[model samples]
Target chain A: MLDFTGIEKERLRARWVSSAEAPEFVEEVNAFIDTLKELGPSPLKAAVEAKKEEQKEAPA
Target chain B: MIETIKQHVAGLLTEKKIAGFLGLIEKNGHVAPHLFKDGESLAGFTLGDRKTAGDARYPLNKTLVTLSRAYPEETFGVLVRGCDERGLYGLFRLNQLTEDRVIPVGFSCPAELSEACECRKPYPDSLVAGEKTESSQLKKVAEMDGKDLARRFDFWTAQFVKCVKCYGCRDVCPMCFCKECSLECEDLVAKGDLPVEVPVFHLTRAMHMADRCVDCGLCDEACPSDIPLRLLYKKTAQIMDTDYGFTSGLNKNERSPLSQMGPAK
Candidate 1:
């Protein structure tokens, strides 16, 4: 669904980690953080920024 | 075509198979849903044809759900198009209505109606009325799917921005039977706030109905903003079908793969 809306599928992640497996949870979170860094800021925020600039540039 | 349905329902009612048959009636040229009980006149029966093929259609299944709950002991027959049949089957699986208590009397969509809906299967497995018409060849979902990611983002953003937050999509949806909706939550969607491209309302709805959408297209029709809601939900349904091999419709026995018990045969 994220992919369908133009968001990278990698921006979302879901994994079941038992509470006993603290290391696994941390690893998953770190991996997602790395992925997010690579993807840059959210495209939704970019759309907001663009819309603001768009108003100043030319009216639709 | 409607004559066949009337005869079938009349026969069923005569045989005491159903307490009543719910269908549309044209009273004074206005189409509305009506329940035909035993010994009632069938003169006003209509298939929601007004100015166009199936232009005045209603979600009879929603009413059927309410009726079944109120009169659980009585079995009822319902007029179902391709989409209504799908909604009935979906409701059956959802446990909102039982299969044995409700009998489906189905009709196929005309070419123009089917094309307008862009339906995959515009007819039920068995028909009481109209003949099976070939599904519309339009591939809006596929066309949308083929676009580059950035283009999709912009396309969807523009569409979502136009939302007046009416929630007409959810209101008109036949497959939506949730007692409590996540969309109304204050944290999830800021109530009475400006419609944002964050698209929490639409996105949540899309994800919620991902496995359950019967492809009825009511959401698309109900949207005042004219958002391609069915197109969006169809994408989610497609992904579910691709990943889990689960598609909701006439096949009542098929279970959602997302469920903890796994797919039921």
Candidate 2:
């Protein structure tokens, strides 16, 4: 997770919560969802989709 | 200088110190890496002219690795420039070859060649020939540093788009010794893609190179598209130095910080 943190910082987040801390885990998940919504779709995903469409539209 | 190197190599061969001496040989006006088994064959040996750096350059360390693996008990000697010595240190750290098994005959690069390579250390650890000169700085990275994030991203993407996915960079690297490379992993990098996923391909390599890259500049030399790979890996080396005062090929006993499992001390 620390390695991935360097590449997609905004998209990926790591939180420390033990199995006993259900409430804390839920809170962290909710916060991450909000962050993702604010950040919108990843540019890499968008690029891949756009490339797929371009390939589909190209001549056979 | 060439005569001195030839004499030293002949001495090593005659003394039975090394089974074979891996050095450049000029035959039919073409210079290539060859293994001289005896002093008789040493007559064909030539220290490639310093005028053409590219012609003189070959992955001698890589050949040493291959030969050493085949003949584990047999010792070998090789001619090494500054970059080659650094690469040898990296290989030693990786446990690819023992220091005792490979004898390095060191030489320094000329000032012009050093400037052209943007080399930091123009001579090896123990210089047998040539004089040590100051290391040169890479101007391309400095130029890129002035650009904004978006501009830099665009610049890199445009440069990466020219890639034909030849993997010449990997093939030519002396320190790349992985049996199964992450670059070839289909899950990470798709197959048969002409340009490959630009970020996934390049960034993945850059991350892997952070601790391993010795600033040899071989990747940049091998790239047919003229992609500034040395600059990218140099940035990784800088990051490693800043975050954890570690640089590749500095000392054989010191392992790369990234290679450790726990947090940096």
TM-score of chain A of 2: 0.63
> TM-score: which candidate is best?
1
Candidate 2 residue lDDT tens string, B1-265 = 7788888888888999998889988888778899988746576676666457544578888889999999999999999888888889999989999989998998888888889877778888867888887888767656766666556655565566567789899889898889999999888788988667766687788888777888888788899988888888877776687789987886657788777898876
Q: Name every residue pair that clashes in candidate 1.
A: none
The total number of steric clashes, by the backbone 3 Å criterion, in model 1 comes to 0
Residue B145 of model 1, lDDT score:
81
Q: Write the per-residue lDDT of candidate 1 for residues A1-60, one digit (tens) a residue.
A: 878888888988999999999999999999999999998888697685666566447644
Cα lDDT tens digits for candidate 1, B1-265: 8877888989999999999999999998789999999999898999988888878888898999999999999999999888898888888888999999989998999988888788878998758877898977548888988999999989888778777788788877888778888877778788787654365668888888987898888888788878899899888878877777777884767777766484443
User: In model 1 chain B, which range of ten residues has the least summed lDDT?
Assistant: B256-265
